[model samples]
Target: MTITRRDFLNGTALTIAAGLAPTSVLRAAEAQGPAYPPALTGLRGNHPGTFTLAHSLAREGAKYPGVLARESYDLVVVGGGIGGLAAAWFYQQRFGGNARILILDNHDDFGGHAKRNEFTVRGRTLVTYGGSAEMPPSANDNAAVRALLAGLDLAPRIQARPGDDYARRGLGRAVFFDAEHFGRDQWLAGDPFAALVDARNAGVRPAPEDLGAFLNAAPLPPADRQALQRLAQGETDYLSGMAGEARARYAQSTRYAVFLREKAGLGLPGLRFLRSRSQDAYALDADGITVAQAISIGLPAGAGMAAPAIDPRLGKSPASRLWFPDGNATLARALASKLVPGVAAAQGQEIVGARFDYSKLDREGNPVRIRLNSTAIAIEPDVRITRVTYGWQGNLQRVEAAHVVVAGYDMMVPFILPSLPVPAKAALRACVKAPLVYTKVALDNWRAFDALKTWRIHAPTMAYSDLWLESAPGGKDDPVVLHMLYVPTVPDSGMSARERFRAGRAFLLGTPFEVLERDIRAQLDRMLAAGGFKSARDIQGITVNRWAHGYSYMPSGLAPDDANLQVALEQAGRGVGNIRIAGADTAGSPSVTAAIEQSMRAVGSLNPKT
Candidate 1:
């Protein structure tokens, strides 16, 4: 069965069209009523109409000439993502609760990458994370993040109950070897990585008996199968002589793919099988991550070598992470509610089901206002006040602020604030973001997964590298949301990490939604057909959260360790006069804690007392 664009658009025609249609048409569409963004389906994240002005100004140096209105605020924040919202929150704490703050974001929704996707099927409301899913345990340890969570009265809820209906039904993990990569369509009953990681973390080597049957059933060559069996059995020491810090350094510095081939004696097919193993976490392939970096993030390590100690600051396992049904988007909503009380009245877990009043977000006379569908194009600093120019509703509007906090992507800062020093701009340009897609597909039922006894499947070579069911208390007959991940990487292309990221961004932007939708349907059909799955019938709706610029680029062993580049990155976050930069990029990490901490630091820099 073939699904069409019309099938996905339950009632989101206006939202989907708003991005593609002309300004005149868009204006007419907005005249109907305020848009409730969470409920809108189809293509999301970096949706159309969001980045047109940004591209125009950055790429073509196009100027917006019209100045429709001029307003003033105590603080102005560019980019209304988590960082921007936190900046506003911190400004209130520092400068008092009455500080007038204006937050401008290009997307119709706030939260930046922390987006929420909602669907209604058979009178049941299903929620899924479109982007920025979890708050790691490390985030809770931060004083600022803890304070923010407390202020919002947000606490983690038990994600899975004692008797999860899906679990009780015996669903587990599996792997799908597609015909294109494995020479035949094959579905294995267990995930080798999951079993191996669990075994390694528990200080036990995985026995061949545990994975032998699964590997033998896989459509892999004999050499590749033997290599995997050896990896599981923990028979060979990849780093035979090295130990302690020396071994750690070597693992941290060497590429994982290289380690597999040269050190572990794995063949080309085995390397391809593991290419996308790291995509879900780092949005990079084996080539982009080092062996130590892979192990730190809980990827399966070679069994013979002692597992490296995991850095507490880095990502932990999913069991330790906490999130609401809509993921960190609930945190965004909570932040918004705290800023503008009219947005939402719910607290804690109730916020998960809260229906934010979009109309109340930007009401006049509010201490804090979040203005959506407004893209900041220029920041002209003056002696007393800085003027921020933005495009809103096909018109250029100007706002003046005593202090300006730029909380958008670091790479785009150079384009927005061209007056920065040469080195500072160069530093900002070096912060390249990885591109990824989080597609949330609403299915009428999860019978296919139930029948297959697998709720998650890792498809390394497919258009989407991973697919899993959301952790909700749903039986096989109930409607459920399936989350799919796609990280665009051009491996072995001889391009640097930054170059590869740019190419991936282009691919995400240039590809049409229809093409993406087709691939999603085809892949799901192929992987689930044996379990009596029919994509066109089972799929109720699809929302592709395409983030051309997704994760902040954190330096890894793949890149040359250059001190000058590190110095430049540090200088980039330093404020010039009244302008400050804050975001996950500023901290060189993609966690929510980084976003909040950087915002707090940016706000603290503006303290008059210091």
Candidate 2:
């Protein structure tokens, strides 16, 4: 079911010798190039060896032929993401400071989604967050998240300030409608949150008339234009039949797409336009989310309706003042320093600029060891200990731990530990994550963005949903990194949540790097042509951080309740023998805070029979 690079190369040799190879493959074979570095420019996620081990377990119910080596530890964590790292840290704090702990990850590097993508262009160092962009101040209120920040000596107030030119150079918000999706590719400049009347709102400087002009000029049918205009002007009576309270309740319980079609009387074009806005946060279309969920995330308030009021407690909470160039990778690095002393430079200083030596991660005799490029294939929990079998360095290895935490994808739990009860397996299987691709592009200079007079552009129909200049503590014309966020949702599939996630994951992994690079360049060329930007000319380097299993599935909208989902999840997470669960998936919310909270719970639930 899976073909790896090794397999492909082996087949390539036979085909070329038999004179049956394709021209492209032959040329690639004959091309004398630098040893191909898959890490440098292409194919970043569901990485070749990473998922093949999991697939062997899931698809074929495989068991390793023999264990080449065996080791024992006090605690073993099966992921190196924020959640897994924090679990080790919490275990150290709670029960044993000197416990022999080991963290294994499938990636060559740690900090799974909290990845720091680095680039050196024009002799200047630049970094961008590949995933996990920002941590809201509200999230830090959780004890676990706050404790982790405190451990890193990152006070909530010590933060990066945007350069003076940021406000001046930044494009507040703009929408681009592509010719394929709409009738034509049209770029319009406007603020998404400008129309609503609210005291808390920081209204756009553009006058109401200017905002109206942007909508009126959209290349839509007469009826669509009229409907948009009415919504924009705040003069629509779409909810005429219901009282104010009833209307509000309907909005909360019903999907926005349904509300638009049934109540707002908008056609497909209008629906598409409104739904595009949701891509900014949920990576979902209007039908995939409820109006309440949309409003909660500040997507859009319905036209002619007053914006919903924020919870007073949340409104009054402190805003996040700390932002590293690499987002929360700083937190992960700080935690790594605590777990393995010499792996990362000690924190309390400017942790963002700290140096990490990956080679020192698994030094001999260290109380806490981090083994990279190790994939957990199976986990079996016994009365006295939990045994984990993993593939490492071309061989199957085994490790026994008094307590084991499976901290990666929740759905894979059933596959990893086949003995899990039926209800527990079903509950773990129900949790599916959204697929995301975050591409960091190096540019010689940001002259194109300046020419376009916008720092960010939202494109729903393009391969990338949105493109924005990576925020740094510098000026606009400086060599900068542009971030393109792509959500490859299989739109109009009419598939269930699990099916859609599987399809999206398959598409994300199967699509090669060359295809992705071509698509990204094409999108950039199409969007920036008006500003005299050329992709090949301006673009210097590209790093695609493909995350097939990104963003945990959180229940929202008018979705029907799976009556037993929560109960089953709770039961599954209650440590089976010496094995437990950790991750954002266990928290049922996709966030760093949730990951930390779940880690704490997982560690606390560990009742080691040993």
Candidate 3:
């Protein structure tokens, strides 16, 4: 009996309602002596309950029938992602811990994208972020985010020693050219960040000439190789006809693909090589993104020329030095623990090792209650109090609150609170998130990676853009998880950025898990065959945390008057009748820093005396 991704997502909702621990279920399955690649192991984010609830609220378009129970609170927050969790913490900060609050999230887990993917293989425990991995250093400057971490005693920083150690183990960067793009499966040992020399470790610099050799060795025809050679050199003035200011303007205004085709003469093959780079960073394709944005992130021939400040080798200081083992999930965990004491150990960043008592999350008489697998269906703001109707345990439940923070996905806000003003709704709709998929593939051993002489591989023409070996907390051999990132996008010749995102979201949600798994297995085998990697033989388990609607929208630099656009969004989210809007949407960016800021805004909108 094979369970599809959709089936598995739906199945988990039932399991959550039954109060069954997913860990116990996994242990029970492991007790059966591991069925090889294992049964039903894909699509792990936006769990079944969350998916169904959002779908029901959106597509169903009907009022939730017959309230199961009625409750009241001083504050009711919708969605339990980082933003909502922070909102709960902020309420505690502003109104004291005595404030009665309830956080309703559709997912079985409360961390939202801050969820975790834990696996135990051969008496070894391997943990990876299910979603919302890594915190930017700028987050440290965010007093709220920093204060929360401080309260939890979590000092977020990457253990560069482990990563450096891993790099020394016959490991480096590699690029994969799928047959669709390059006419054959080819892996080249080279650093993709060759142009931004400083981005690589201090001693791990690959010279331009060395990278040229790697490109020349690609299984491309002579002409293609020559074109690639020129691209690698970065000395070619490909904009020959358009010189000086014209060239500068062309570089800034022209789409990278056009610059590549018309100016650089990269042809179809050369362009394909650079296509994945854009999608991996922003969800935009070559056609959709401007050459300016492309250069800012580093790509094409003149990327470093335009953006010297981004060059890591030039001693350019990064925004911050804050990132955790499980990304921002650690922050989410910290916030949850603060809101619900004893839910997680009060220990520092090592909270990953602490087991959360979910049963205690929504215990009676607690000032703060986080109810998992509960979805907010509707919110009605009145003069005195806001009424929120949510679904929990397959029943519609109503909760009234003096203040309601609708801090879920921005797009869902209009649907959940239909009476919102038209302009605000339009502004909310514009906050569409970029869909992303992050997969963790556990392997029995990592000898294949060593044999291949690469730790990371980027596939421009495949479903997955890049994959690399993820390090566990403690350095050990034999068992490891290969983390792969997939941004579901295919260039639509005639679609706006938002339209393309919608199409990509549909494509991602509609696609089955088996297809994704097959691609993962096949791509791994093709890339690592030289090192003796057979997917079925060495693959232990795969957890695909599919966030069909991922990163929050931040207006493109090319977009007109970024300040005004944000002002419009902020005005739109000002909330009607105490139904204050919050989350990354109101922040006009998907960053955790913005989420925390919006959380403060949402709580601040109410009377401080309340």
All candidates: TM-score: 0.91, 0.86, 0.86
Task: List all candidate RMSDs to the true structure.
Answer: 5.3, 6.7, 6.8
**Candidate 1, lDDT over the whole model:** 0.78
Report, for all candidates in order, the number of backbone clashes: 0, 1, 5
- For 302-400, candidate 1 gives per-residue lDDT tens digits of 644446455443322433354676778888988898899867868566888888889999999998999998878889888778889887776667998
Off by over 4 Å in 1: 1-34, 66-69, 161-165, 202-205, 242-249, 300-306, 310-320, 561-567
Show where candidate 3 strays beyond 4 Å. Answer: 1-41, 66-69, 161-163, 192-206, 222-224, 236-253, 300-305, 308-322, 472-477, 492-494, 557-564
Model 3 Cα shift for residue 232 (angstroms): 4.1
Between candidates 1 and 2, the TM-score winner = 1
Model 2 over residues 289-379: C-alpha lDDT tens digits? 6666655544444444555433221211123333666776777777888788876565755667776777778877898988877778788
Q: Candidate 2 lDDT (Cα, whole model)?
A: 0.68
TM-score leader: 1
Which of 1 and 3 is the better model by TM-score? Answer: 1
Whose lDDT is greatest here? 1
Candidate 3 C-alpha error for residue 315, in Å? 22
When summed lDDT is taken over every stretch of 10 residues in candidate 1, the lowest stretch is: 1-10
Worst 10 residues of 2 by lDDT: 29-38
